[model samples]
Target: MTREVRLTPVNEQNLEPLLSVAVAEAEPDEVMPPVDAPAGWSQARRDAFREFHRSHFGGLAGPTGNLMYAIEQDGDVVGMIRLGRTDEPGTLETGMWLGKSTRGQGIGLIALRLVLAEAIAAGARRVVADTRPENLPAVNLLRRSGAVLAQDGTTVRAEIRLGVSEDVDLLDAG
Candidate 1:
Protein backbone atom coordinates (compact mmCIF):
# COMPACT_ATOMS: atom_id res chain seq x y z
CA MET A 1 0.00 0.00 0.00
CA THR A 2 2.49 2.58 -1.16
CA ARG A 3 0.99 6.11 -0.94
CA GLU A 4 2.80 7.59 -3.94
CA VAL A 5 3.08 10.89 -2.17
CA ARG A 6 5.21 13.72 -3.52
CA LEU A 7 5.63 17.42 -2.93
CA THR A 8 4.70 19.56 -5.88
CA PRO A 9 5.71 23.20 -6.06
CA VAL A 10 2.64 25.38 -5.69
CA ASN A 11 1.96 27.37 -8.81
CA GLU A 12 -0.81 29.23 -10.57
CA GLN A 13 -2.13 26.09 -12.26
CA ASN A 14 -2.55 24.13 -9.04
CA LEU A 15 -3.77 26.92 -6.77
CA GLU A 16 -7.44 26.42 -7.53
CA PRO A 17 -7.37 22.68 -6.87
CA LEU A 18 -5.34 23.29 -3.75
CA LEU A 19 -7.91 25.76 -2.54
CA SER A 20 -10.76 23.42 -3.40
CA VAL A 21 -9.19 20.50 -1.59
CA ALA A 22 -8.50 22.65 1.45
CA VAL A 23 -12.00 24.04 1.62
CA ALA A 24 -13.61 20.65 1.23
CA GLU A 25 -11.25 18.50 3.24
CA ALA A 26 -9.65 20.70 5.89
CA GLU A 27 -10.65 23.34 8.35
CA PRO A 28 -9.10 26.78 8.02
CA ASP A 29 -7.62 26.61 11.50
CA GLU A 30 -5.93 23.30 10.72
CA VAL A 31 -4.27 24.59 7.58
CA MET A 32 -3.95 28.36 7.76
CA PRO A 33 -4.24 31.34 10.04
CA PRO A 34 -7.54 31.92 11.77
CA VAL A 35 -9.79 33.54 9.21
CA ASP A 36 -12.69 35.51 10.60
CA ALA A 37 -15.48 34.10 8.51
CA PRO A 38 -19.09 33.26 9.33
CA ALA A 39 -18.45 29.60 9.89
CA GLY A 40 -17.69 26.93 7.28
CA TRP A 41 -15.57 27.62 4.20
CA SER A 42 -16.89 31.01 3.32
CA GLN A 43 -15.82 32.98 0.25
CA ALA A 44 -13.72 35.28 2.38
CA ARG A 45 -11.84 32.37 3.92
CA ARG A 46 -11.32 30.87 0.47
CA ASP A 47 -9.93 34.15 -0.83
CA ALA A 48 -7.66 34.44 2.16
CA PHE A 49 -6.33 30.96 1.57
CA ARG A 50 -5.42 31.86 -1.99
CA GLU A 51 -3.74 35.06 -0.95
CA PHE A 52 -1.87 33.32 1.84
CA HIS A 53 -0.18 30.94 -0.55
CA ARG A 54 0.27 33.56 -3.24
CA SER A 55 1.84 36.22 -1.02
CA HIS A 56 4.14 33.91 0.85
CA PHE A 57 7.15 33.90 -1.47
CA GLY A 58 8.40 37.37 -0.57
CA GLY A 59 5.96 38.46 2.08
CA LEU A 60 6.62 35.92 4.81
CA ALA A 61 7.46 37.08 8.32
CA GLY A 62 11.02 35.83 8.09
CA PRO A 63 14.33 37.26 6.98
CA THR A 64 14.27 35.01 3.93
CA GLY A 65 11.50 34.12 1.53
CA ASN A 66 9.40 30.95 1.66
CA LEU A 67 9.00 27.97 -0.62
CA MET A 68 5.58 26.28 -0.59
CA TYR A 69 4.72 22.84 -1.91
CA ALA A 70 1.42 21.14 -2.41
CA ILE A 71 1.28 17.78 -0.71
CA GLU A 72 -0.05 15.54 -3.44
CA GLN A 73 -1.15 12.00 -2.77
CA ASP A 74 -1.66 10.08 -5.98
CA GLY A 75 -2.02 13.36 -7.86
CA ASP A 76 -4.57 14.96 -5.57
CA VAL A 77 -3.81 17.89 -3.33
CA VAL A 78 -4.26 16.83 0.27
CA GLY A 79 -2.27 19.50 2.07
CA MET A 80 0.74 21.81 1.96
CA ILE A 81 4.35 21.89 3.12
CA ARG A 82 6.48 24.98 3.57
CA LEU A 83 10.14 25.81 4.08
CA GLY A 84 11.42 29.23 4.99
CA ARG A 85 14.58 30.84 6.18
CA THR A 86 15.23 32.25 9.63
CA ASP A 87 17.46 35.11 10.68
CA GLU A 88 20.03 32.57 11.77
CA PRO A 89 22.46 31.55 9.09
CA GLY A 90 22.45 27.95 7.86
CA THR A 91 19.04 27.30 9.35
CA LEU A 92 15.50 27.05 8.00
CA GLU A 93 11.97 26.64 9.37
CA THR A 94 9.31 24.18 8.27
CA GLY A 95 5.55 23.79 8.58
CA MET A 96 2.85 21.57 7.13
CA TRP A 97 -0.77 20.47 7.32
CA LEU A 98 -2.69 17.48 6.02
CA GLY A 99 -6.37 17.19 5.28
CA LYS A 100 -8.43 15.49 7.99
CA SER A 101 -8.95 12.47 5.78
CA THR A 102 -5.19 12.05 5.49
CA ARG A 103 -4.31 12.17 9.15
CA GLY A 104 -2.88 9.21 11.14
CA GLN A 105 -1.16 7.87 8.06
CA GLY A 106 2.59 7.84 7.26
CA ILE A 107 2.18 10.56 4.64
CA GLY A 108 3.51 13.20 7.02
CA LEU A 109 6.71 11.35 7.74
CA ILE A 110 7.34 10.95 4.02
CA ALA A 111 6.61 14.62 3.51
CA LEU A 112 9.01 15.55 6.29
CA ARG A 113 11.79 13.53 4.76
CA LEU A 114 11.16 15.02 1.35
CA VAL A 115 11.19 18.54 2.75
CA LEU A 116 14.34 17.80 4.75
CA ALA A 117 16.05 16.55 1.62
CA GLU A 118 15.07 19.76 -0.08
CA ALA A 119 16.56 21.68 2.84
CA ILE A 120 19.77 19.70 2.69
CA ALA A 121 20.09 20.15 -1.06
CA ALA A 122 19.63 23.88 -0.53
CA GLY A 123 22.54 23.78 1.93
CA ALA A 124 20.54 24.30 5.09
CA ARG A 125 22.43 22.95 8.08
CA ARG A 126 19.37 22.71 10.28
CA VAL A 127 15.58 22.67 10.02
CA VAL A 128 13.15 23.63 12.75
CA ALA A 129 9.44 22.99 13.22
CA ASP A 130 6.98 24.36 15.75
CA THR A 131 3.71 22.77 16.76
CA ARG A 132 1.35 22.80 19.70
CA PRO A 133 1.79 20.27 22.52
CA GLU A 134 -1.61 18.89 21.65
CA ASN A 135 -0.40 17.94 18.16
CA LEU A 136 0.88 14.57 19.29
CA PRO A 137 1.09 13.22 15.74
CA ALA A 138 3.33 16.04 14.60
CA VAL A 139 5.49 15.71 17.71
CA ASN A 140 5.93 12.01 17.10
CA LEU A 141 6.69 12.53 13.42
CA LEU A 142 9.30 15.13 14.28
CA ARG A 143 10.93 12.85 16.80
CA ARG A 144 10.96 9.89 14.43
CA SER A 145 12.44 12.14 11.76
CA GLY A 146 15.30 12.95 14.15
CA ALA A 147 14.27 16.31 15.58
CA VAL A 148 15.11 17.22 19.16
CA LEU A 149 12.02 18.51 20.92
CA ALA A 150 11.85 21.39 23.36
CA GLN A 151 8.61 22.61 24.85
CA ASP A 152 8.08 26.29 25.63
CA GLY A 153 4.72 26.61 27.26
CA THR A 154 2.13 25.40 24.75
CA THR A 155 4.51 25.42 21.82
CA VAL A 156 6.74 22.47 21.02
CA ARG A 157 9.78 23.27 18.91
CA ALA A 158 11.51 20.49 17.03
CA GLU A 159 14.97 21.07 15.65
CA ILE A 160 16.78 18.72 13.29
CA ARG A 161 20.47 19.04 12.49
CA LEU A 162 20.72 18.14 8.82
CA GLY A 163 24.51 18.26 8.71
CA VAL A 164 24.94 15.12 10.75
CA SER A 165 25.59 11.93 8.83
CA GLU A 166 23.49 9.91 11.25
CA ASP A 167 20.54 12.23 10.80
CA VAL A 168 20.83 11.92 7.04
CA ASP A 169 20.97 8.17 7.49
CA LEU A 170 17.80 8.29 9.50
CA LEU A 171 16.10 9.94 6.57
CA ASP A 172 17.00 6.98 4.39
CA ALA A 173 15.93 4.37 6.93
CA GLY A 174 12.43 2.97 6.33
Candidate 2:
Protein backbone atom coordinates (compact mmCIF):
# COMPACT_ATOMS: atom_id res chain seq x y z
CA MET A 1 0.00 0.00 0.00
CA THR A 2 1.27 3.42 -0.89
CA ARG A 3 1.49 5.77 2.13
CA GLU A 4 1.52 8.95 0.00
CA VAL A 5 3.61 10.54 2.72
CA ARG A 6 4.14 14.28 2.35
CA LEU A 7 5.27 17.24 4.43
CA THR A 8 2.72 19.90 5.17
CA PRO A 9 2.74 23.04 7.24
CA VAL A 10 1.24 22.88 10.74
CA ASN A 11 -1.50 25.38 11.33
CA GLU A 12 -4.33 25.93 13.82
CA GLN A 13 -6.57 23.61 11.84
CA ASN A 14 -4.24 20.64 12.37
CA LEU A 15 -2.58 21.51 15.68
CA GLU A 16 -5.37 20.08 17.80
CA PRO A 17 -5.35 16.75 16.00
CA LEU A 18 -1.63 16.48 16.54
CA LEU A 19 -2.04 17.28 20.21
CA SER A 20 -4.86 14.81 20.36
CA VAL A 21 -2.33 12.13 19.54
CA ALA A 22 -0.35 13.05 22.64
CA VAL A 23 -3.48 13.43 24.74
CA ALA A 24 -4.61 10.04 23.61
CA GLU A 25 -1.52 8.54 25.16
CA ALA A 26 -2.90 6.40 27.99
CA GLU A 27 -0.36 7.80 30.44
CA PRO A 28 -0.87 10.54 33.00
CA ASP A 29 -0.33 13.93 31.36
CA GLU A 30 2.56 16.15 32.28
CA VAL A 31 3.80 19.55 31.10
CA MET A 32 7.33 18.28 31.40
CA PRO A 33 9.75 16.85 28.89
CA PRO A 34 7.53 14.23 27.29
CA VAL A 35 4.50 16.54 27.39
CA ASP A 36 1.19 14.69 27.25
CA ALA A 37 -2.47 15.13 28.17
CA PRO A 38 -5.86 13.46 27.90
CA ALA A 39 -8.89 14.00 25.72
CA GLY A 40 -10.44 16.40 28.20
CA TRP A 41 -7.09 17.92 28.94
CA SER A 42 -6.87 21.10 30.96
CA GLN A 43 -5.85 24.52 29.70
CA ALA A 44 -2.46 23.99 31.29
CA ARG A 45 -1.70 21.04 29.05
CA ARG A 46 -2.81 22.93 25.99
CA ASP A 47 -0.66 25.88 26.94
CA ALA A 48 2.38 23.70 27.50
CA PHE A 49 1.94 21.83 24.27
CA ARG A 50 1.42 25.10 22.44
CA GLU A 51 4.47 26.65 24.04
CA PHE A 52 6.72 23.74 23.10
CA HIS A 53 5.45 23.68 19.55
CA ARG A 54 5.45 27.45 19.37
CA SER A 55 9.20 27.39 19.71
CA HIS A 56 9.40 24.86 16.97
CA PHE A 57 6.96 26.79 14.78
CA GLY A 58 7.16 30.48 15.64
CA GLY A 59 9.14 31.37 18.71
CA LEU A 60 12.79 32.42 18.73
CA ALA A 61 14.68 30.31 16.25
CA GLY A 62 17.23 27.87 17.57
CA PRO A 63 20.85 28.13 16.48
CA THR A 64 20.63 29.50 12.93
CA GLY A 65 16.95 28.83 12.26
CA ASN A 66 14.21 26.24 12.42
CA LEU A 67 11.51 24.68 10.24
CA MET A 68 8.64 22.44 11.31
CA TYR A 69 6.50 20.24 9.09
CA ALA A 70 3.43 18.12 9.62
CA ILE A 71 3.81 14.54 8.50
CA GLU A 72 0.72 13.45 6.60
CA GLN A 73 -0.13 10.07 5.16
CA ASP A 74 -3.08 9.76 2.82
CA GLY A 75 -4.36 13.16 3.95
CA ASP A 76 -4.16 12.34 7.69
CA VAL A 77 -1.59 13.59 10.10
CA VAL A 78 0.67 10.81 11.37
CA GLY A 79 3.64 12.65 12.86
CA MET A 80 5.85 15.76 12.94
CA ILE A 81 9.32 16.70 11.73
CA ARG A 82 11.44 19.60 12.93
CA LEU A 83 14.64 20.82 11.29
CA GLY A 84 16.92 23.30 13.01
CA ARG A 85 20.20 24.60 11.78
CA THR A 86 23.35 24.19 13.82
CA ASP A 87 26.09 26.75 14.30
CA GLU A 88 28.15 24.99 11.73
CA PRO A 89 27.70 26.07 8.14
CA GLY A 90 25.81 23.91 5.66
CA THR A 91 24.51 21.61 8.38
CA LEU A 92 21.03 21.09 9.78
CA GLU A 93 19.69 19.03 12.67
CA THR A 94 16.40 17.18 12.54
CA GLY A 95 14.03 15.45 14.96
CA MET A 96 10.78 13.60 14.40
CA TRP A 97 7.96 11.77 16.18
CA LEU A 98 5.25 9.52 14.77
CA GLY A 99 1.97 8.57 16.34
CA LYS A 100 2.23 5.23 18.16
CA SER A 101 -0.13 3.63 15.69
CA THR A 102 2.03 4.86 12.82
CA ARG A 103 5.28 3.29 13.96
CA GLY A 104 6.96 0.36 12.12
CA GLN A 105 5.00 1.06 8.95
CA GLY A 106 7.82 2.62 6.88
CA ILE A 107 6.42 6.11 7.33
CA GLY A 108 9.39 7.27 9.38
CA LEU A 109 11.78 6.39 6.60
CA ILE A 110 9.70 8.29 4.10
CA ALA A 111 9.63 11.30 6.39
CA LEU A 112 13.41 11.14 6.83
CA ARG A 113 13.93 11.15 3.08
CA LEU A 114 11.51 14.01 2.59
CA VAL A 115 13.23 16.06 5.26
CA LEU A 116 16.60 15.34 3.71
CA ALA A 117 15.36 16.35 0.30
CA GLU A 118 14.19 19.65 1.69
CA ALA A 119 17.41 20.23 3.59
CA ILE A 120 19.57 19.47 0.60
CA ALA A 121 17.48 21.72 -1.58
CA ALA A 122 18.03 24.46 0.97
CA GLY A 123 21.82 23.98 0.58
CA ALA A 124 22.50 21.90 3.63
CA ARG A 125 25.73 19.95 3.44
CA ARG A 126 24.76 17.47 6.11
CA VAL A 127 21.83 16.50 8.29
CA VAL A 128 22.13 15.36 11.87
CA ALA A 129 19.68 13.80 14.31
CA ASP A 130 20.04 13.32 18.04
CA THR A 131 18.07 10.79 20.01
CA ARG A 132 18.46 9.15 23.37
CA PRO A 133 21.06 6.41 23.27
CA GLU A 134 18.77 3.95 25.01
CA ASN A 135 15.95 4.41 22.51
CA LEU A 136 16.72 1.38 20.40
CA PRO A 137 13.93 1.99 17.95
CA ALA A 138 15.14 5.50 17.24
CA VAL A 139 18.76 4.33 17.05
CA ASN A 140 17.82 1.60 14.66
CA LEU A 141 15.69 3.94 12.60
CA LEU A 142 18.60 6.27 12.07
CA ARG A 143 20.97 3.43 11.33
CA ARG A 144 18.56 1.97 8.83
CA SER A 145 18.23 5.38 7.26
CA GLY A 146 21.95 5.19 6.52
CA ALA A 147 23.01 7.72 9.12
CA VAL A 148 26.32 7.33 10.90
CA LEU A 149 25.63 6.84 14.63
CA ALA A 150 27.70 8.18 17.51
CA GLN A 151 26.65 7.70 21.10
CA ASP A 152 27.55 10.19 23.78
CA GLY A 153 26.52 9.69 27.40
CA THR A 154 23.04 11.20 27.04
CA THR A 155 22.48 11.65 23.33
CA VAL A 156 22.99 9.45 20.31
CA ARG A 157 23.83 11.52 17.26
CA ALA A 158 23.24 10.33 13.71
CA GLU A 159 24.50 12.20 10.68
CA ILE A 160 23.98 12.00 6.92
CA ARG A 161 26.07 13.84 4.41
CA LEU A 162 23.80 15.35 1.81
CA GLY A 163 26.51 16.12 -0.71
CA VAL A 164 27.07 12.44 -1.22
CA SER A 165 24.69 9.98 -2.77
CA GLU A 166 23.92 6.31 -2.23
CA ASP A 167 21.36 4.15 -4.02
CA VAL A 168 18.70 4.23 -1.28
CA ASP A 169 15.20 2.99 -1.72
CA LEU A 170 13.00 5.85 -0.62
CA LEU A 171 9.79 3.94 0.00
CA ASP A 172 10.77 0.35 0.65
CA ALA A 173 14.27 0.35 2.18
CA GLY A 174 15.36 2.50 5.08
Candidate 3:
Protein backbone atom coordinates (compact mmCIF):
# COMPACT_ATOMS: atom_id res chain seq x y z
CA MET A 1 0.00 0.00 0.00
CA THR A 2 1.11 3.57 -0.57
CA ARG A 3 1.77 5.45 2.59
CA GLU A 4 0.31 8.87 3.27
CA VAL A 5 2.84 11.53 2.34
CA ARG A 6 3.03 14.99 3.89
CA LEU A 7 5.46 17.86 4.05
CA THR A 8 6.56 18.65 7.58
CA PRO A 9 8.15 22.03 8.01
CA VAL A 10 11.78 21.50 8.89
CA ASN A 11 12.35 22.35 12.52
CA GLU A 12 14.57 21.40 15.40
CA GLN A 13 12.24 18.58 16.37
CA ASN A 14 12.47 16.76 13.04
CA LEU A 15 15.92 17.67 11.85
CA GLU A 16 17.54 14.62 13.38
CA PRO A 17 15.13 12.21 11.74
CA LEU A 18 15.71 13.93 8.43
CA LEU A 19 19.43 13.54 8.82
CA SER A 20 19.03 9.92 9.88
CA VAL A 21 17.12 9.20 6.69
CA ALA A 22 19.76 10.93 4.61
CA VAL A 23 22.68 8.99 6.06
CA ALA A 24 21.13 5.55 6.40
CA GLU A 25 19.04 5.33 3.25
CA ALA A 26 20.92 7.65 0.85
CA GLU A 27 24.49 8.19 -0.15
CA PRO A 28 26.33 11.38 0.64
CA ASP A 29 26.54 12.27 -3.03
CA GLU A 30 22.82 11.84 -3.49
CA VAL A 31 21.64 14.33 -0.87
CA MET A 32 24.50 16.58 0.14
CA PRO A 33 27.39 18.62 -1.10
CA PRO A 34 30.83 17.03 -0.93
CA VAL A 35 32.29 16.76 2.51
CA ASP A 36 35.77 15.84 3.67
CA ALA A 37 34.85 12.16 3.83
CA PRO A 38 35.08 10.24 0.58
CA ALA A 39 33.02 7.28 1.79
CA GLY A 40 30.51 6.65 4.53
CA TRP A 41 29.01 9.27 6.85
CA SER A 42 31.94 10.61 8.79
CA GLN A 43 31.78 13.11 11.60
CA ALA A 44 32.52 15.87 9.14
CA ARG A 45 29.80 14.76 6.75
CA ARG A 46 27.22 14.43 9.50
CA ASP A 47 28.10 17.83 10.83
CA ALA A 48 27.87 19.29 7.41
CA PHE A 49 24.40 17.89 6.98
CA ARG A 50 23.24 19.47 10.21
CA GLU A 51 24.82 22.76 9.29
CA PHE A 52 23.15 22.78 5.93
CA HIS A 53 19.69 22.39 7.40
CA ARG A 54 20.41 24.68 10.32
CA SER A 55 21.33 27.47 8.01
CA HIS A 56 17.78 27.53 6.70
CA PHE A 57 15.89 27.36 9.97
CA GLY A 58 16.00 31.08 10.54
CA GLY A 59 15.07 32.09 7.03
CA LEU A 60 11.96 30.37 5.67
CA ALA A 61 10.05 33.43 4.57
CA GLY A 62 10.69 36.81 2.92
CA PRO A 63 12.04 37.51 -0.54
CA THR A 64 15.40 35.83 -0.02
CA GLY A 65 14.46 33.07 2.41
CA ASN A 66 13.79 29.47 1.43
CA LEU A 67 10.92 27.27 2.46
CA MET A 68 12.19 23.88 3.60
CA TYR A 69 10.27 20.80 4.51
CA ALA A 70 10.96 17.19 5.29
CA ILE A 71 9.06 14.67 3.22
CA GLU A 72 7.34 12.42 5.71
CA GLN A 73 5.74 9.15 4.68
CA ASP A 74 3.36 7.70 7.20
CA GLY A 75 5.00 9.86 9.84
CA ASP A 76 8.58 8.86 8.97
CA VAL A 77 11.06 11.16 7.39
CA VAL A 78 11.83 9.83 3.91
CA GLY A 79 13.12 12.80 2.01
CA MET A 80 13.18 16.57 1.73
CA ILE A 81 11.86 19.33 -0.55
CA ARG A 82 12.83 22.97 -0.60
CA LEU A 83 11.47 26.03 -2.41
CA GLY A 84 13.33 29.28 -2.69
CA ARG A 85 12.73 32.55 -4.43
CA THR A 86 14.44 32.76 -7.78
CA ASP A 87 16.06 35.69 -9.51
CA GLU A 88 12.87 36.15 -11.43
CA PRO A 89 10.04 37.48 -9.34
CA GLY A 90 6.95 35.35 -8.73
CA THR A 91 9.03 32.26 -9.45
CA LEU A 92 10.29 29.70 -6.99
CA GLU A 93 13.08 27.23 -7.59
CA THR A 94 12.78 23.79 -6.04
CA GLY A 95 15.00 20.82 -5.29
CA MET A 96 14.33 17.47 -3.68
CA TRP A 97 16.00 14.16 -2.87
CA LEU A 98 14.50 10.95 -1.61
CA GLY A 99 16.11 8.02 0.10
CA LYS A 100 17.03 5.12 -2.17
CA SER A 101 14.60 2.77 -0.47
CA THR A 102 11.62 4.93 -1.35
CA ARG A 103 12.59 6.03 -4.85
CA GLY A 104 10.11 4.05 -6.95
CA GLN A 105 6.96 3.97 -4.87
CA GLY A 106 5.39 7.13 -6.29
CA ILE A 107 6.42 9.01 -3.16
CA GLY A 108 8.15 11.68 -5.19
CA LEU A 109 5.08 12.52 -7.21
CA ILE A 110 2.95 12.83 -4.11
CA ALA A 111 5.53 14.94 -2.37
CA LEU A 112 5.84 17.07 -5.48
CA ARG A 113 2.12 17.73 -5.66
CA LEU A 114 2.12 18.64 -2.01
CA VAL A 115 4.96 21.10 -2.58
CA LEU A 116 3.10 22.59 -5.50
CA ALA A 117 0.24 23.38 -3.18
CA GLU A 118 2.72 25.04 -0.89
CA ALA A 119 4.10 27.04 -3.76
CA ILE A 120 0.70 28.27 -4.81
CA ALA A 121 -0.11 29.19 -1.25
CA ALA A 122 3.10 31.17 -1.11
CA GLY A 123 1.94 33.31 -4.02
CA ALA A 124 4.31 31.93 -6.56
CA ARG A 125 3.32 32.17 -10.20
CA ARG A 126 5.69 29.39 -11.27
CA VAL A 127 7.91 26.69 -9.89
CA VAL A 128 11.16 25.58 -11.52
CA ALA A 129 13.41 22.62 -10.98
CA ASP A 130 16.69 21.54 -12.51
CA THR A 131 17.86 17.99 -13.07
CA ARG A 132 20.13 16.01 -15.28
CA PRO A 133 18.78 14.06 -18.24
CA GLU A 134 20.41 10.91 -16.95
CA ASN A 135 18.25 11.08 -13.83
CA LEU A 136 15.27 9.49 -15.53
CA PRO A 137 13.20 9.31 -12.39
CA ALA A 138 13.37 13.05 -11.75
CA VAL A 139 12.81 13.80 -15.42
CA ASN A 140 9.70 11.66 -15.42
CA LEU A 141 8.42 13.19 -12.21
CA LEU A 142 8.71 16.70 -13.58
CA ARG A 143 7.03 15.67 -16.80
CA ARG A 144 4.16 14.05 -14.94
CA SER A 145 3.84 17.22 -12.87
CA GLY A 146 3.17 19.26 -16.01
CA ALA A 147 6.46 21.09 -16.21
CA VAL A 148 7.64 22.59 -19.49
CA LEU A 149 11.19 21.41 -19.78
CA ALA A 150 14.12 23.19 -21.40
CA GLN A 151 17.64 21.85 -21.52
CA ASP A 152 20.86 23.79 -21.29
CA GLY A 153 23.89 21.62 -21.75
CA THR A 154 23.71 18.96 -19.02
CA THR A 155 21.01 20.61 -16.95
CA VAL A 156 17.31 20.14 -17.67
CA ARG A 157 15.19 22.93 -16.28
CA ALA A 158 11.58 22.05 -15.62
CA GLU A 159 9.25 25.00 -15.24
CA ILE A 160 5.70 24.56 -13.94
CA ARG A 161 3.36 27.50 -14.06
CA LEU A 162 1.00 27.52 -11.08
CA GLY A 163 -1.99 28.98 -12.83
CA VAL A 164 -5.36 27.30 -13.28
CA SER A 165 -4.77 23.75 -14.53
CA GLU A 166 -5.72 20.15 -13.88
CA ASP A 167 -2.72 19.66 -11.63
CA VAL A 168 -3.48 22.76 -9.55
CA ASP A 169 -7.09 21.69 -9.25
CA LEU A 170 -5.99 18.30 -8.08
CA LEU A 171 -3.73 19.93 -5.58
CA ASP A 172 -6.69 21.90 -4.32
CA ALA A 173 -8.92 18.83 -4.04
CA GLY A 174 -6.29 16.79 -2.29
Estimate the Cα RMSD of every predicted model relative to the unseen true structure: 5.6, 6.9, 5.0
| Candidate 1 segments whose C-alpha is farther than 4 A from its true place | 57-64, 164-174
Which lDDT tens digits does candidate 2 get at residues 1-174? 766999975667778777776566422232224545544466766677766665656511443266777788998877788777676666778888887788889888899999998877666778899888887888988998889999888999899888633343222221
Best-performing candidate as measured by TM-score: 3
Better of 1 and 2 by lDDT: 1
lDDT of 1 by residue, 87-128 (tens): 676677999988888888899999999999898876678899
Q: Tell me, by lDDT, which candidate is best.
A: 3
lDDT of the candidates, in the order given: 0.83, 0.72, 0.85
lDDT (Cα) of model 2: 0.72
Clashing pairs in 2: 144-174
Q: Give residue 25's error in model 1 in angstroms.
A: 1.8
Runs off by more than 4 Å, candidate 2? 26-42, 58-64, 164-174
Global lDDT of model 3: 0.85
